[model samples]
Target: MITVPQLDQYKDLIGEDQLSQIYDKVRALSGLHVMHFNTTERGGGVAEILQSLLPLLEDLGIKHTWKVVPLDDTSNHFTAHLVDMLQGNIPGQLEAEDQQAFLDTLAQTPILSRPQDSQADLYFVHDFQLAPLTTLFPWLRPAIWFCHIDTANPNQYAKEYILRFLNNYNVCAFNSQASVFKELPREHVQVITLGIDPFKNKNKYITREQGMQAIARCGVDPTRPLITQVSRFGRWKNPWQVVDIYRLVKQHIPNVQVALVGAMEAADDIEANDVLADLRKYAKGDPDIHLLHDPTMIRDQEVNAFQRYSSVILQRSSREGFGLTATEAMWKEQPVIGTSSTGLRSQIIHEQTGYIVDDTQTSADYTLKLLQDRDLWRKLGQQAHEHVRKNFLFPMIVLGYLDALTKAMAFAHAQPNLSGGQKR
Candidate 1:
């Protein structure tokens, strides 16, 4: 079992007054039980958020349970395609066979038995993978469909299919307003940005020397300025463009090295291997261009080291959900150069928090500036860290969830026919 530090432990970082306010909100949510459902228990942003959030919820005296729907080879392939369609990569209806496979897979999962055993007040169905759970289990009242993806321009068919399940939820939460579909009721929508645990292995405090040593173990020269982008190998993350940006940066700074870090084991992301293979081919044996995705080599400690020691971090995603990588870097007082994706826009304040660029040229330009100008880098890094501390930390996110749950419960109570908690 994974243990999360107690809420009180964050008192110093979040301030005593703010922590007290969080407890007040917890009082309002007294007796509430939240059930979270997703495709996998590890990898990806959703799992990371839940891993921290759920344990904290337990510590707060809230009843909660997490369940992962089992995915076989067939279902995994179908759902991966489904994710692409939802993200607007595939702009058509899911094939009939694929839809059937998705449904069949869900039907076999033991999650169906969970509704009977667990008396959850709210069902928090994450992303499109398990959105249909609201419909599959009619008793799941006051459910919140928390979507952590770039759904600003999802495929029409995918949008319609997802809406069918979303309509059943009490609230539809998104990382940004841009991700919310127009079809969803205005009242049903809630924009709750994702957050990072400051004390987690990936974001915890480490000395500069320790950071340097950790990166050196991974073959990264500690002396050279490192430009890193840590995210999963998703097409939307724009891993290829990161390589382009690196090459552009290397043009001016000969000693500069770029590390493209990503997780390759996300079950829903079947395209990771393909994208990584293509990235390797594109790099063409550039000695400075480090493509670090081996889980054994680049775990949380190494990521923490890279972010802490790097001159600048890049989150040049084409369409990011919330860019937790940027948030992580920001929390570590590392300046990030991100694209104008909605999520990045929400986290970055342009020149104030961090720089936001449109293309590889601008991204490269910003990277060069941050590397060359030490004072500018420190200014942005300090501002970025403060911004994350105020807005993107885990305690703030818990407050957001508590507020959303309070509103959802009220919404459910207002509906004459609807009722929350277990039916049995």
Candidate 2:
């Protein structure tokens, strides 16, 4: 038989009072039919977050359904271009045809058809990819756009279209500061942090022998200082820059081995394979740099094992929604070095938990400093683990969503024509 854990089980970590507060609010969300729509079903931070979150919402007596708004190859090509637009790659204005294609693709997807078919109390759409779908399904109850990307900086045309699409939702959700998602001060934006489950399969405890075995399989040398960056092989993730930083670290600490572990998600990401292949060729001469994929590892749990075995983890995204990999690393008591902007700005507390580096030299300096002094990372690791436990766990994220849904409902109630969802 299948088993679901209790909400009160978190009391030991968060304390009785805190869990009680969560439970109180969670109970209020009972029978709430929540639908979370996103681009991919398996890859990236959004999918992984939903993997833990949707189930917990069900355990809390909320009817939660997670669906992927898939795109065809033709549509996905345009979608990838849209991702570029969000990353500020597209110059000048988006051609009117591309803008229409963006909306038209989402409109044609069958996954979104369920929103109009079923009676969901609230719609929680994730990322900019699915933001336009709300315009086609305003009757799907109160909608909240979960903008997981840095919307503040984008092509002017892309920003204009995104902000216009966002207006369809009653409110928008963000994890970073006001500058990341706020198009205007008047827009109703909910700042909710993304999270990771330390108790999940990847975050669960592993014996030394098992961890060593897993590391050995990844071709990571246990004696050498291991630096790992776990992210999709995307340009925005700055994977090439990460490899360059590792080379810089090698000059200072030659024994250091850098593991770039990534897996292609079933998203509309068209450039993943080309990027991964190019990076593989870029690191062909380096014996110390281990480039791995999910296919050879067999499962994502191995990536977790690599993180647990790592000396330090790197999530240095040039543009990040929120780097969940950094949180996963921190939870494992590993010192994480991430970039200083986007979601990484809020997660890594500079010298407190981990270092935030802007360039290769800065990253190398911090990596060398930590490697030279064992005591610093140990203390930082302890603090990093506590940071995730307190702020970025599954229970806390459930509460964040609850708070967003509450705001969405209130926003809906204020609308005389759009009044359909509950108020609690």
Query: Which candidate wins on lDDT?
Result: 1
Local accuracy by lDDT, each model: 0.81, 0.76
* Candidate 1 wrongly placed segments (more than 4 Å): 1-5, 416-424
Instruction: Give the runs in model 2 whose Cα sits over 4 Å from its true position.
Output: 1-4, 112-116, 184-187, 296-298, 416-424
lDDT of 1 at 79: 72
Compose the digit string of candidate 2's lDDT tens values, residues 153-222.
6777677777776656777778776445445434366777777776778888887778778888777787
Model 1 gets an lDDT of 0.81
List the pairs of residues colliding in candidate 1. Answer: none
lDDT of 1 by residue, 3-89 (tens): 235877787777878677778888777668998889888889898899889878887778889988767878778777776777755
What are the RMSD figures for all models against the true structure?
Answer: 3.2, 3.4
lDDT of 2 at 285: 77
